[model samples]
Structures are given as structure tokens and as C-alpha cells.
Target: MTNHRTGAAEQIAMRGLLGTLNDELGSPLAPEWERAFWAVPRHAFLPETVWLGDDLTTYARGTAPQTWLSTVYADAPLVTQINDGKDPGDGERWPSSSASAPSIVFRMLDLLRVHAGHRVLEIGTGTGWNAGLLAHRLGAENVTTIEVDPSLAIHAALALKHAGLEPRVISGDGAAGFPAGVPYDRIIATCSVRQVPRAWLEQTAPAGVILTPWETPWLCYGLLRLTVDGTGVASGWFSPHASFMLMRNQRTDLRIYRDVVRDEHVPAQSVTLLSPWAVTGDDWAAQFAVGLQTRTVWHTWHDNPGVDGVASRLWLAATDATSWAAVDWDGRTDERFTVWEYGPRRLWAEVEAAYAWWRQVGSPGPDRFGLTVAPHGQHTPWLDSPDQPVPSTG
Candidate 1:
């Protein structure tokens, strides 16, 4: 499709999207930001299509201008590239880049509390939409974005230029932050991270805010907002209901459940019982469970063939060993669990402890917990009383 036709449709979609966002977000974002959103044609930053599952055949792509605009504007995420540089084309198992869903983008923006004239640094410049919005609010000169992929960085630079904005686009590790743009008023990460990178805390200015999704052991994520204190520590709240892609460097562990857990080889009597659903449900409960019982990381997978035909498996692994449990939802709660835990701590116990903490707290939402970071380290605190700190680990 021609650029002109694509631009026109994007403009119309932007207006509609802005209206919906305004209603949903309730004034955290200013009206002027809408202009930047409309000006940047999202389709310009995307590939033709993307894979949705491990299977190469099941995917979504933009075949025409309208499809591109609709895909870009929809509340759903639009995959921009896959498999990093290895396989930019579709039919790949990996998803390297994407225009995050509109709602998630807006949610992060709202959490950042971006305002006119605030200097911002963005990590993971996927689609460059977040940077575009920041540029609209803070001006191109005041915004800088970094991406690890050289090709994706180039595409983002070209897309920003095509939109009539020229933010400094750097091709480097986002975890390192843009040192040249240090002392930023705000730093926002479009990616998920296992731990708060020391560079992000170092580069941020005193009183500046850093917002990113923190990956938990439960396979769930939370938005951590920290206020940097020129030295290296940041403290803030853990926003509720947030998740994102793990940082490229941190995306490890692709082992399947069957390989890790041993039901036949290991005796079932050695395994302890734990509720997988408790960890996969909502925040407070999940976090509580993870903190108390889970000494290690665990993940659950669910597959349903049809009504009453569901299979669920929970994979539990520690920094040292692996074990798992399986549950069949075929009208009977027939479940089997096995363990080969050789680590200092039991993984299943940790999972149960997290759930117990959730119940103890009466199941508080993620918003109730806050995060604080220092050059010394990062901590989660109760928002109501910032002085109280919650223990956080890598």
C-alpha cells in the first residue's frame, strides 16, 4: 500500500483510539499527546505479519493498508518482527519486536506521569510509538530511545523520520540506558526484566522516575515504579495488572514440562502438594503464594481441545533441579505430582508459601505494593506508608 493511503487511515484511527484512551485512562494523558499519536503512522514501524503461536502457520499479518491500520490501532498487540535478525520473516518461533497493545502503552504512560517539557529516555524502541508520544509531549530533542537490534533500530529511526519527528535513536543495549542522555526526567522500559538494571538507576536524574515491568518467579509480571536518588536507589509503587516481554538477555529457560518433571522416575510420595491456579490467578494472591511457598520458579500451561477436555500441567524447577505436577480436567480432579528436588530449598513449598501470604493479606491487589530502588538495591514498599519496605530478590 502507498504511504499516503496508509497515513490517512492511521490519522483517522488515531483520533478514534485517542478518544477511547481518554475515556479509559480518565485524564492522565493530555489532549496534546493525541496529536503525536495521530502524526506517527504505526503501520510504518511494523512488518507484514507475525506468528501468534509456536506453530508457524497460525499468525496475523497486514495484507493491506486498512488491515495494517486496524491491526496497529486495535487494543491487541501487533507483532512487528520475529526471531531478532535470524528470521525477520514470518513462520518463526521467536517474537523479537512488536507494537505493544494500545491499552498497555497508555497504561505505562499514565504510570510515568509524563508531562510537557519532561525529558524522557525509553528502552526497547519497538514501533517507536511510545517515543513518538514522548516526543510529542517533550519534543524530539528532549526524547531518546535505545533498541538492541540494529535493524529494528533503523526501522524505528526511519519511521520516526517519516512521521516528521527526529528523536535520537541509538542502537545499543537498553539495559545500559543512554548514558549520553543521563539525568532524564523519566525512563520507561517497553520490556520486562528479571531485575532492575543498575545502569537504569545510575543514569536517571535525582527525583526522576523509572517504570518497567518486573518479572516474578510465578510467570507473572508487575509494573515497578522507582524514584531514583542520584546515588542509585529508587523507590516507588508496583502498579497493578501489568505484564510485558522479558528483556532479550533474560529470556532463558525454554524447557518443556515433560522433560523437567519426572513422575515415573521419582517417587510420588516425595512430592508435596501445591495449587497451580493460585499462582496463575491475580496479583495479591499469586504474589503472596510465590513469596511464602515458592523457593524456586514455576510455570503452568493449559490446553483445551474442546468442552470438558482440558489438560493442565505445572512445571516446578529450582536454581538446581527440576520436578513437575500434572492435572487432567476430564471431569475428575485426577492429579499426579513428582519431585526430584536436590536444591537447598524445596520448590513446591515456596509456591504454597506465596499463596499463604496472599490469604494473610486478605488478597491485596498489586497496586497496594510499592517499589523503591537505591544504588544499594531495589525494594517493594507499601504505598500507604513508604517507609515500610518489602523484600525483593533477583
Candidate 2:
């Protein structure tokens, strides 16, 4: 009787928490989605151990029940698996899988605009909560979820079963998609991808929507929703706020090394009146513009006083580690800053041209930008229509 009462209390608490989350999200969830949220408990899908806080401190449910319950219901994402289930000597580890934040999940679902009888294919079924929710609304038979990690797939399958739902859980690469479940009315990926795969476009039904987190080397993440046409092309606009962990195969590692530069080499030195902060700071619109124009380059910033009273420096490096540029900002009242570039590619020049193009085009935001994926997996970022492709900085 005591256990029954505890379960009942938890259900009530979960309902209340869901209500709060719904309100915070501006009540965007459909009535069916809300019902599904109440029916499918997120706590059941979470693992026994999770990482908490920025430091990735390990938290076990058995050791701290209150913290576990609180975190399980929180709107924030919970890191369930790290370093592909391997231990790091330090607590800090790369998060390979996570239960996405509830609000973002709902937002993605809303963008998907699925219907009651719609056949849905979900990629990256991290913890099965999303699958459970989809199953609750569209019936388990209408939902097919795929996870790359076999362990995660098994655990998600078990969790869905425990929740009294049975969505088809497949263990395979999400990029390839599931041809068995081809012609899905809607497809969604919980993970982020550098480029939408050709298989996704080929497998989706005509007029069906594909939603996923999209990223470029210049910008970490954005939400993309593309609608497939009969011509084997998909086009869509991006939302700035969405972010997610990169899909395993799409991850890139770039670091700085001195050997890439030669002592005999000399780079052209120049100064620009543009402030680095103006381009790299909170202005995501500019960043997106730069990202689409400049390929395979990322930027980092630092603050400190140099011998010439330079207060800040912005560094850019290529993913191949073959090119690098540094822009220095001194304490001078003037807007001009010093730039140094190495390697065959002049990265800073490309950035400046990109930023200039963005300004010339009226400084559009993510919504103003769109993506076009060709049948062969080539991606073309556009300003407004698919006809006007954004040119890359050469």
C-alpha cells in the first residue's frame, strides 16, 4: 500500500511539473501531446546514473532520491551517457547521448506538425521518452525509432515497454535512416547533423517534413525543418535557438599547432575597422551569415593586455588545421584592429567579406535564411528563395 501511494504521489507530481513546463513553453503543446506527456513519464526513461551541473558531476538515483526526482522532472536536459559509456578519470566527459530538454522536444514536435494517423520515424531515440510520447499520441504502430548505439536502443526499448508502450526500436545508423519505414509522414532527429543525408531525403514521403538540429563549422547549432518535394530536394528555414549534441559520425576535432606554420613564411598584414565582438558576440545572425559563407572554419576569443596594450584577440582556425588567423584589438579609441593570417587560405579576409555581405543584404536572421539539399547531398544555403543561393567567401 505504501509503494502504491508513493507511485500515485509521483504521478501527481509529474503531472504538475508537466503543466509548469507547458506554461513556460507558452502552451505550444497540442492537446494530444499534453495527454501523451501525462501518460508517458520521463523519469522511467532516465538511467540510474546521470551527469549534473556544468562540471558533469555524476548523480546516482539510489544515493540521492530527491535530487534524482527533481532533476528528472526539470525542464533541462539530463546527460545520460558520456564518453560512449566509458569512464573519464576526471568527471568531465563528452556527452554522447542525452534526454533532450522537454521544451525543445515539444518545440520540435510542434514544428513537425504530425497528425494522429501520421507515420513517424524518429532518429536518435536517446532515452525513449520521445518515442513514448509519440506512441501515446499516434499509437505505437505508427512510430518507428532508431538509435545508433545498440545499448541505448535496448535500454530505450525496455523503457518504452515499461511505460506500457511499444514503439519499434531499431539499432542502426540514423544517417542511413530506415528504408523499411520509408515514406514516413514526418521524420525528426534528436541529434544534430552537419548535413542532411541523401537517404533522409530519398526516404521521406513527398510533402513530408524533416526536422533536425543543423550545424556548420562556423556556427555550432540551429534548428532546421525541411519539406521534401517530388524532385528529391528538401528546403527549409532555420531557427536560431535550437541546439543539440552532434551526431557521432558528424563530429569534428580541430586544434592549434605550431608546425602548421613555417618560419620562412610571411603573411599579409592588414587592419579593419570592424570590431570582432560585433561579429562574434551575441549577433547570431551575423555568425550564421559568416558560417554559410566561410566553410570549415571556427573562431575563439581571448582577453588580456599585450605589450602594445592590445586588449583582446579573436582567433580563427580551419577544421583541417591547415589555416589560421588572428585579429587583435588594442586599447586605441579607433575602430581598426590588426589581423594576421597564415597558410594558403586567408581566413580573416573571408570572414570580413562574409560579414560585409551580411550587412549589404540587410543583416538577416536565421528565419530569413534557408537550406537546400540536392539529391546527391550537396547543401546550399540561401538568403530567401532556393534560387538565390548564398555565395561562399572564396
Candidate 3:
């Protein structure tokens, strides 16, 4: 499709999406915000295809105009990069860039409570769309975003420049907050973080807000809104459900499990006990449970021997190698898992406990939870209520 046609279609979609979002949010989204949404061409920042399959082979690409349009405004994420580090040639499953869905973006913005003049620091500069929107509201000079990947950082910077908006775009580790522009009025992270980084709290101004998706043991993601006290202490509630890629360094290490789990050790019992398909498709419940109990460590893969059907292998391990669980799947048959450990607690049992906790809470939505942060080395609880202190399980 021609650029004009694509832009026209995007405009229509944006108007409709904004209207729907406004109705759902029970308030009119700010006009300037709406204008920013309308003005940015989302597809310009996306790649030709996005992998939507369990494996890297399958994808949803922009082969046709309709296909591109459908993928662009479908209220779903479109991947822009895979395992080429910062390049796009490698046919891997890693996702480096994405046009985050409109609803999720709006949810984060709503949590941010960004006003006309709030100075904001965004953690992930994926497509530059988010930074553009913030720049529209707070003025270009007041927004600063940090991206870890140098190639992605350059692309995003060019994209923003093309859109005629300028924000202090830096290529650096977002985990280390942007210090040159310290004490921001608001800090919003577009990436998912296993732990709230200490730099964020330290850099936020007094009474400022820090909004990001907090990793949890539930099936859904939590949008945490924290209020900084200017003393490296912040507390607030988890306001919504959203997800993002884990911080670059915090990504799960799959080396050991990938090497250990082969065809010979495929357990027959876990075959039916766990669904391979369901497990691969973003099982936040299982992922978060394993993350909390094992300190953000896990590995999973499918077991396919010769011409026989497919089974799955799940290895839950800790950083210290103190605990591990090997669950196998043979089609749909049950396979008894061998839980091995010499740790303070059984990893699999903790996963089961977290799952049970979810059921006991009536499977509460992610929006109901919250996060509170104190400076690094300072212990504080992320409570469900302002008064109720959540005991540290770590």
C-alpha cells in the first residue's frame, strides 16, 4: 500500500481506538494525547513481519496492505526484531522491537497520570511511539528515554527525529536510571522488570510517580504506580494488566536446561500433566510462580525424538543450583517429575504454593495488586493494601 493510504487507515483506526479507550476509561483522553496518537505513523517503526507462532518459523508479516493494517491496529503486539542482536536477519524467537497495543499503552499512561508539564523518563525506547506521546504532552525537552540496544537506540532516535519530536534519547542500560536528567517528575518503564531497580526511586522527585509493569506470581501482569518521597522510598498500587520483555540482563538463562533436556530423559508422566502448547503461550501463572520461587530462573523446550509425536520438557532451576524440577510431556500422558534439591526450600512446591495462593485470592486480576519500593539494600514490602505489609518471600 502507498504511504498515504497506510497513514489514512492508521488515522481511522487511531480515532476509533481512542474513542473506545475513552469510553472504557470513563473519561475523555486529553486532546493533545489523542493528537499525538493520530500523528505518529506506527508502521514506520515496525518490521515487515512479526513472529506470532510457538517457533520462529511461523509469522504474521506485512505481505499485503490488509495484512499490515490488520496487524497494526489489532489491539495486539507486533514484533519488530528477533535474535539478530540489533539486526533483523536472524530467524530466531527473540523480540527486539514492537508496536505495543494501543490499550496497553493507554493503560500505562493512565497509571503515569502525566500532566501538561511533568518531566518523564521512559525506560524502554522500543518504537519511539511512546516517547513521542509523552513528548507531545510534556514538551520534547522534558522527556528522556534510555534503550539498552545500540542499534535499536539509533533506529528509535531516527524515528523520533523523522516525526519532528526531540527527546533526550540515550543508548544505555535502563536499569541504571538516566542521571543527567535526574529527579524526573515521573518515571515510566516500557519494559518488564523482575525487580524494581533502585535507580528509578533515587531519581524520582518528591511526590513524583513511577509506573511500570511489576512481575508477579499471578497469570496476569501488574501496572505498579509508586509515589516517590524524594528519599529513595516509594509506595503505591498495581493499577492494571500489561506485559513487556524482561530487562536485557534479567532474561531467563536457558543454557543448562537446553543442554540437559534431551530425548532420552523425557518423562512419561508429565507428558499429560503439562500441556506443551499452553506452556509455550505465555503462561504467566507458571512463569511468575517459577520466577518468585526460583529467583527468576527456568528453561523449557519440546522433546521430539525421530518421527514420534512431540512432548515437552520443563526444567525449573535456581541460580545457585540448589533446587531443580524436571517435568516431561509425552503427548498428553502423565509423567512423574523428579524434583531434585539441596536448598532452603523445594522449588516446585513453592510454585504450587503460589498457584494455590492465586486460587485462594479468587484469582484476582493483576490490577488489584500493588508495588512499594525502597532504595537498594532497604527492605520494604509491596502490599496489597497501604496498611497490610507483604512479607518478603525472597
State the lDDT of candidate 1 residue by residue for 1-394, as single tens digits: 2243454566788667777777767663555655556655555566556544344333444345466556556666665666675744545366667667777787887779877778899999987778887787778999999999888888778778877789999999998888887788899999987678888888888889899977655654678888887567787776665567788887656464434644444423354454455566554546533542342465556566243444544455553344443433443453534433433455555555556655676666666766555575544445346775443331
Q: Per model, how many backbone clashes are there? A: 27, 0, 11
Q: Against the true structure, candidate 2 has what lDDT?
A: 0.84
Candidate 2: misplaced stretches above 4 Å? 1-9, 258-266, 302-312, 330-334
lDDT of 3 at 377: 35
lDDT value, candidate 3, whole model: 0.64
Worst 10 contiguous positions by lDDT, candidate 3 = 266-275
Runs with alpha carbons beyond 4 Å of true place in candidate 1: 1-8, 27-29, 50-62, 88-92, 254-274, 282-296, 302-312, 319-331, 334-342, 378-394
lDDT by residue for model 2 over 81-170, one digit each (tens)? 998977777565778888888888888888889887899999899989999999998999999999999999999998888778998999
Model 3 agreement with the true structure over 159-229: per-residue lDDT tens digits: 78877788999999999998999779999988776678888888889999888876532222556678988
TM-score, every prediction: 0.82, 0.91, 0.78
Clashing pairs in 2: none
- For TM-score, the strongest prediction is 2
lDDT of 1 at 269: 32
